[model samples]
Structures are given as structure tokens and as C-alpha cells.
Target: NLTTNISPLMLMVMSLERYVAVCYPLRHASIITIKNTTLSIIASWTVSLLNNLTRCLFLLQFSLEKLETLLVKDYCYDINWFPDSLRERYDKAYTCLVIISAGLAVISSYTGVVLAARSASTDKVSALKARKTLLLHLVHLGLSLSSTVYHPLLMALSTLVTRIVFVWVQDVFYVIIIILPRCLTSHIYGLNDKTIRPVLLYHLCGQLKISVKPGPC
Candidate 1:
């Protein structure tokens, strides 16, 4: 679960980078050059790795021998040994941090996209394309927010089956959040822009190649 959680956060950071590059080309080029963008990506990944590692440290502090003895097949670490209040406090803090950060990212990105689209410098075709891209990102932004919001409610819900169903639904929605932006940006921007043509083709060919691959990694 730690590994899985990290991917979404990394992707969110990538999406933010994309929004900056697309919507604020002039400023982005000046401030977020290739080297800076690469550094940002590395930083996001590093932070996520450290966050997961911190969770592991907590696991080490609390012994897991009993959980191992119980034969729980899939759990990477035991949480039950921690006091419920302590667990809930961590949960609340994590949820709040993610929600606020993601929300601000979405707002900033969306506003930038909107301003870019409305600019007098943007021609008709470019404006239309930018709007389409913004819409695609907005869908993803909404889903990301919904998933974060749903998580705490899912935890607080009384019924076990309801919680299970809620989590599964959120998981599927989260997958969509990962995939939709990639497809939309790659294809939609690639259609008209000579610069993004390679990116479009890359994602397209990549998808086809994955389709033919033997099995899931």
C-alpha cells in the first residue's frame, strides 16, 4: 500500500508540472526549465520515498512479531498494535495535508489554464484546444479531491461491507485519475502541435506496446 500510494502523489506532481508547462509557456520556460523540471520530479519522488520510509520506521518502533505470527498474508506492516487514537491522529494529519495540497494545486493549475485560454494572444484553435485540455484536467482534479475526501468517510463508516465497497470504488476512480490525464494531454495536444507530436506518439505507441506485453509487471 505504501508503494501504491506513492505513485499517485508522484503522478499528481507530474500533472502539476504539465499544467505549468502548458499554460504558462513563457514563465515556465524561464523558471521551470528542463533541468528544474527534472529536479522537481526527482524531489517529488524522493519525498514520497522518504514518507514511505517514515511509515516503515513507525512499524519498526512498534513490534510486528504478533502480526507475523497471526498469518496475515498481504499486510506489509502491522497497524493494530498502535493505539486507535494515535492511528486516527496520523490519519487525520495525512488526510488534511494531502487534501489541502492537492486542492491548492488544482486551483492554481485550473486558474492558470483558464487564464491561458482567455488570453488575447491565444488564437482560436489554440484556445479551443487549451479549453479541452483544461476540461480533461478538471475531471481528474475533481476525482482526486473526491478520493481524498471519501477516504476519511470510508474509515469512519460503521459497516464493514460499506467500507469495503467504498474503498474499492475509490481505488477504481483513482486509477482513472492516473490514466485519463495522460491520454488526454498526449493525444489532444499532439493532434495539432508539432512540438508535442512525439509525446503523443510516444504515449500512443507505449500503450500499444503494453497491450501486447505478456503479463502485468
Candidate 2:
């Protein structure tokens, strides 16, 4: 959950960095200095930690004894942990807030970059690549947000499917919604970044190949 929260925040930071770099190239160095970047990262992690701590407070209403008695399967789901109406409402509200705010920030940042890219002074190729990377960030954000609906979707499917089929479907959703998004960030950046692509591909392909020339974004 900490990682999930931090991921979008980090993406927002990246988007803003690109926004400044493309939209105001002359001022980017001064505006996005190493100290500022470090502080932004620290702030992001702090916010994520605080958010998760608040989430933990929701579990406090349940006594340890009560929690121990609650029946659970071999695997525990977040819905099971948050069985009460209060937690459910809080979860929904928080999820929507994060998705909307982060989505808007990223979209606005990328839109600015795109507009700046059209200017005669900007490097069109670099700006175009940044735009593509931002698009991927949006896709990743959507995938990450989809996990919030996983339980409700599974519950809806449970009535229509057989037990065996439902179990298989659950596994599929678990992988697609809960797992894949976390893994995509590395692949997205690694392939798009020229400096990292060769090294990423070398290790990914068992270190047999030392170089790979990828096409433009």
C-alpha cells in the first residue's frame, strides 16, 4: 500500500520535472535543482507514510481478539480487513481523491509539455518522447487505480461463475490488477531511456547480448 501510494506521487513529480524542462528550458535548471528534487521526494515519501498510517488507524476499532476470530481463507484480501462501513467509505473516498488529483496534475503537466513542444524553440523530438512517457504514466495510473475496484468486480462475478471458474478468474484479476502495474514502471522507463536500455536488455536477455538499438518513442 505504501508503494502504491508513492508510485503515483513519484510519477507526478516526474511529470512536473518534464513540464519544466520542456516548457521553460532556460529556467528548468534553477527551478528543478538537486536540492529541490530531493526535498520533493522526501515530501512524497512523508505523505505516503502518513496516508498509510491513517489507514492503519481504521483497523484500530477492531480489537486484536476480534481480528483473531474473524474467519479468513488461505489468502487475505483487503476487503476482508475492511469489513465495516466506515472503512469501506474511507477507502472509496481516498481512492477517488488520489486518482482524480494525481490524474489532473499529470494530465496538466503533460499537456503543457505537448504545447511547448510545438514551439519553434523547443526540441520537438525530446518533447515528443516525454509526451509518450507521460502517456504511459497515465496508463500506469489507471491500472494502479483499477485495483481499488478488484473486490467489487470479483463479488459481482462470483454470482455468475462456478466456484472453480471464479477462483481462476480471481487469480487472473489478482495478477492483472494488483501485480502487473507495479512491474511496468521499470520496463517503461528502461526501454524508453537510451542510457538504461542496453543494460536492461542485456540483463533481461540473460546477459548474452550487450547492446540493443531501440526505435523512437
Highest lDDT, which number? 2
After superposing candidate 1 on the true structure, give the runs of residues whose Cα lies further than 4 Å from its correct spot: 6-24, 64-85, 142-217
**lDDT tens per residue, model 2, 13-118:** 8888888878888998999999999999999899889888887788788887777656765445666775479877777787778888889988998889878888
TM-score of each: 0.58, 0.85
> What RMSD, rounded to one decimal, does every model reach?
7.4, 2.5
Q: lDDT of model 1 at residue 73?
A: 46
Clashes of 1: 0
Candidate 1 clash pair list = none
Worst 10 residues of 2 by lDDT: 74-83
Off by over 4 Å in 2: 63-69, 73-76, 158-163
Q: List lDDT for all candidates, in order.
A: 0.55, 0.83
TM-score of 2: 0.85
Tens-place lDDT per residue, model 1, 89-131, is: 6656875776667667656766676677677775545445545
What is the Cα-based lDDT of residue 145 in candidate 1? 42
